[model samples]
Target: MLDRLDQLQLRQLRSALPRMLEPVMKPNHPTPEVMMASFLQAVDKTNKDIASFQEAHLRLQADGVFPRARASQKNSKGLKHWRASEHPDWANPDRKRSQIS
Candidate 1:
């Protein structure tokens, strides 16, 4: 359907589209560059907020607010296979003898 529009119709629709967008522009519409600048300001603020959060997190870690992690014998590293020859209990798996011999 959009493909059917001629150049003039496309131009007219392009002019009207921004007005349809939320925070609707009316008699005096802001240029696309102006909208982009507003968007950039928001992004800058978000970046600063993230930086502040990251700095606070780093401060906490440096001050040892969180306990230091200790490694245990079973502390997860990765899968390991133990030999049955070394651990005899594992050599013979549980088996049920015949109820009636």
Candidate 2:
């Protein structure tokens, strides 16, 4: 059973765990603690997977897998909008109007 768990892909862990635990878990088996540890491990694995995916995406972007649009220097209209930040002060009525301009 443990060998089967080791073989499971990170994506398969969620569905496999509940089914495996249901029949074998008992009142005095300390299953809850074991389950919690398993749950944490799954969460950690998921986070690592997401981080790896994001890194791969960034690397692809850097490699120009997706091209970014080039901005024209003569286009002041488009440039002003791009510089607008959503900082707290940016929401102020005075700053909001000026920032967009």
Candidate 3:
């Protein structure tokens, strides 16, 4: 969603958002930047945590919930198009050492 915005638009939104949200904000409440950062972090985790993601999907499937088909989905197929991958050296240094042994 944020990918569409240019730097100026993003700056404008960031500057305007605080004033807009101030009316209902509590004294100890998080700023929009912190909230958005946390939200984006969570969203990034959903894409990176394969084992946890698959486990959650398996549980959902057992409950008769299924993901929608991607055939009609028009977004870029980056990681979704991948079938397999090797771990980077930094990502699995212990396994790399074991393989050498």
Best prediction by lDDT: 2
Query: Model 3: which ten-residue window has the lowest total lDDT?
Result: 64-73
Better of 1 and 3 by lDDT: 3
- Per-residue lDDT tens digits for candidate 3, residues 1-101, read 23433555445444554544444354553686776665566545444444444455566566543334344355556545533354245467788799889
As for model 1, its CA RMSD to the true structure in angstroms is 21.5
lDDT of 1 by residue, 8-79 (tens): 544544444343343323334468776666556655655565555556556756765444433433564774
Q: What's the C-alpha lDDT at position 65 in model 3?
A: 36
Instruction: Report the Cα lDDT for residue 69, model 3.
Output: 36
Show model 3 residue runs off by greater than 4 Å: 1-28, 51-101
- Candidate 3 total steric clashes: 0
Score residue 59 of candidate 3 by CA lDDT.
Answer: 67
Best by TM-score: 1
- Pitting candidate 1 against candidate 2, the one with the higher TM-score is 1
- Candidate 3 global TM-score: 0.23
